[model samples]
Every structure is written in structure tokens, then in C-alpha cells.
Target: MEDITIHEFDFALINEFFTELERQGPGSPEETIRALGFIGNLSNKTKIADLGCGTGFQTMVLAQNTEAAITALDLCAGSIDKLNATAGKLGLQNRVKGIVGSMDNLPFQNEEFDLIWSEGAIASIGFEKGLNHWKRFLKKDGYIAVTYESWYTDERPAEIEKWWLDAVPEIGTIAHNISIMQKAGYIPVAAFTLPESCWIDNYFVPQKARQEEFLKQHAGNKTVEDMIAFMRHEADLYSKYKQYYGYVFYIGKKM
Candidate 1:
């Protein structure tokens, strides 16, 4: 058995996840952008860098909603390829430039962007590393908007606890996320709790359904077994941790 991080699992299943997003409806990405403080500030003066911008859904939305030029990046070449293809089709190729790279080490000049945006990707390298590593890319007074899971209470369900221990092993709860950001010289601007329904409707239930359908269609395939394993793991996590686990959208400015 190969040891894989949650980020790797997510990258491998990006296509299915995007399908789930589409099925879940529009507000998913829209709410994410709004939470990131991009809703009202999309203007020509802003230059945005979207790290781990898988498939460019938010990249396209940012380009359309805001006049800012966006440099969308991801570690996965497949994701960048998909994002570029989609951008070309949408005629947004000019506004959004796709880059293939790692988030741990960004390929940009210091203080290059007015805003750094990450949705569901900061945890790939851990929140503290993300805060410290990405800070140099933001100009003085620039902001970063990130979303990560936050703990609602001290009580954690066993399955959820087990998954994190097995997978990430080192991530802190939401309170730790806030402390990490502040300690890294970012002033907390805005924070919001993501509704639990978003996870159930957008990730858990849809992923379960998709895995089931795939298994039905491709019975006895070895690949189906892997897919089923991933889905079952996710379902177990959500079932046990739904109450204590939630996402927090944090907006912080360089101090």
C-alpha cells in the first residue's frame, strides 16, 4: 500500500469532485469567493494569485466578476491543463494565466500580488506553512483569503479523529489556524463559519453517490475498489465528525 496525503487523494479525484460541485449548484464557488473578500473588490487595480486553483472555476469567476488579472496555479499538471482548456473555451484565457507549480514554494517575485486566494488547498501543506510561505508574495497591506476546517467544539467523533490522525496527523483545529495566521503577522479581517450543509450536500453525499454509480457501471474492476475505499473513508469521516467539524473562511491582511 502506498502512503498518500489527503492532497494527493484530492488531486487524484479532482474530476469527480468538480462533477459534484456542478451538481451541487452555483452558490458553491460564489460563496467561496465572497468569503474570500473578492466579491466587491474585483477591479483593474487588483492582481490576484489563486494557489491550487483546480479547474479554474473560481479563476473564471474572479476574472468575470472582478477586473483584476489572475495568475492561477496548481501543483497538478492535469489540473492546469484542464484550467487552461476551460479558460480558452470561455474566452477568459487572456485574463487568467495558468501556472503549474507547488504552493509550498510559489514562483513569483516578492510582493507581486494584491491578493492571494486559496480555497480548500492551504491544508495541503498545512495552514502555518501556507501563511508563512505565501506572505512574501503579497504586497504590503495585501490580503489572503483561505478556507480550512475549524472545530466547533472540543468533542471529536472517532472516525473523524481517526481519519485526520491517519491522513494529515499534524493539523490543528480552527483556533490554531487563527493563532497561526496572527503570529505570522497577518491581521484578521473577516472570519465566517461555513454551514455543515455545504459539506453534506457538496462533498459527502455526492461523492458517495458517484462512487456507488461507478461501481455499478464498472463492476469487478480493480479501479473501482480504490474508488470505493476512498469514498467509504470520506463517508465515515463525515458521519462521525459532521457536528464538530466545519469550515472557516478567513481573510487576513499583511501587517
Candidate 2:
């Protein structure tokens, strides 16, 4: 038999990974809605594109709170399916559309949307590239809002920096986020850091508990073993880089 790859992990396992991440409070969908609300009113029935809209949690929020017509995109087919199902259940099917696609190569015409939103996904692609690539999709004077992992202080520990470099080699330091937006022809409108407690309470503990339960159920399954290994590698990096780090939400207007 050929060696199975990490990408070959069952959809259930991947779903478990993200579902657990969503259960934590403060980082929940409600929090995202409130955060974006702080930037400006979303009542204009604007056309919006949500890139990397995992499972459509934030996308649904935007749909509910704003009169905006939303197009939600994700790379994972399963996630896109769940998003669509949720949208239908919420009666937002007409207002929001889901697409399974890549952020690097958006499948939309130039100036297609009045606003673009992303959360916890741009790091998977390079931040600068993601910002630059998606900018063209925004209409002139349109807004782009994104949440990225960033450090709170100007001084960062070497180990923490190394961990980020190794794990997410593409994202530059937190200090560079604003500058990246500016260089991409976006005028920075607002910026704020999410609390570290959000991650600890929401992502780390719940995911760890879920993984433990899975281990008990699956026993010696090889796929389970691979999942455990991959998760531990990521957790180790997280711990090493566990300082006063959080997501920085940047709201920008296209120039």
C-alpha cells in the first residue's frame, strides 16, 4: 500500500479539528460580529466576499447583521458543504453563496465586491500575498477586514519567533501587518488585537479534550496515530510561541 499523506486524513477528523476550535467563547462567531461592528456600520446591503470563510460562521454573522450580499469561499469542500447547509437552515441561502476555491487565485472579476472579510485563514497563505491578491476584488473605496495572528509587544522572544517562522513561515511579524495593508493600496481604518485568553479558552483546551476522547475511541488506528502526531507537532509550536500573542483585526479602505 502507498503511504497515506496528512491531507488524506478523514473528513470527520478535519471537521473535529475546526468544530472544536469554534466551541471556545470570545473567539466565537458572536465575537467576530461585535468586532467588525466596531469598525463601521454594515447596513448598506453591500456586496461582500468572505475569503477563507471556514464553515461560514463569520459569513453567517455578516449575512444576518448586514444587508450585504455575501459570497463565502473556502478551500475545503466539506467545509463549503457545511456552510451551505447552515446558510439554508438559517434562511440565508438567498443572501449568501458558498464556493470552494483558493484565496491565492480568486475566481471573481475585478471590483466585484464592496467589502472583503477574512479570519484566521490568511496565515495559511502568505499574508502579504493574500492581501495583495484579494485587493483587486474590491471596488474603489471598498473595505477589507482581516484577522491575523500577531504579537502584542514590539519585543518578541527568539523561540516564539522561531516557532512562528517554522510553523507559518509565510506571515511576517505582527508589526508588519499595517504596513502590508498600506503598501497594498489600502488605507488602514482601524486595528486592534484580540485577547490571548480567546485562544486558550476557545481553541487549545477544547481541541485537546476532543483529541483525548478520539484516542480513547480509536485505540491503535494508524490514522488516529497520524492525527495525534500532527496535532502534537502543532501544539508544541503553539506552546513555544505562547506569549502575549493574538489576532490583529485590520480594517482598511481601498485607495
Candidate topping lDDT: 2
* lDDT tens digits by residue: candidate 1, 113-219: 98998877777688888999999999998989987766667667675666665655655676777788999999888877777666766656666666777678767
Q: How much does candidate 2 score in TM-score? A: 0.83
Q: Can you write out model 2's per-residue Cα lDDT over 1-255, one digit (the tens) per residue? A: 123333457867766566534431225565677666754545666899998887887888888888888999988777888889889999999999999899988999999988999887787677788889998898888889888877666677776665555656654555588898899999888887666565666666667777888888888888887877776665565566666466778889999
Error of 2 at 202 (Å): 2.1
Residue 145 lDDT (model 2):
87
Model 2 lDDT-worst window of ten: 19-28
What is the clash count of model 2?
A: 1
**Off by more than 4 A, model 1:** 1-27, 38-42, 212-224
Q: What is each predicted model's overall lDDT from 0 to 1?
A: 0.73, 0.76
Pairs of residues at least 3 apart in sequence or in different chains that clash in candidate 1:
none
Name the regions of candidate 2 deviating beyond 4 angstroms. 1-16, 19-26, 38-41, 216-218, 221-223, 229-241
How far does residue 228 in candidate 1 sit from its true spot (Å)?
2.5
The Cα error of candidate 1 at residue 33, in Å, is 3.5
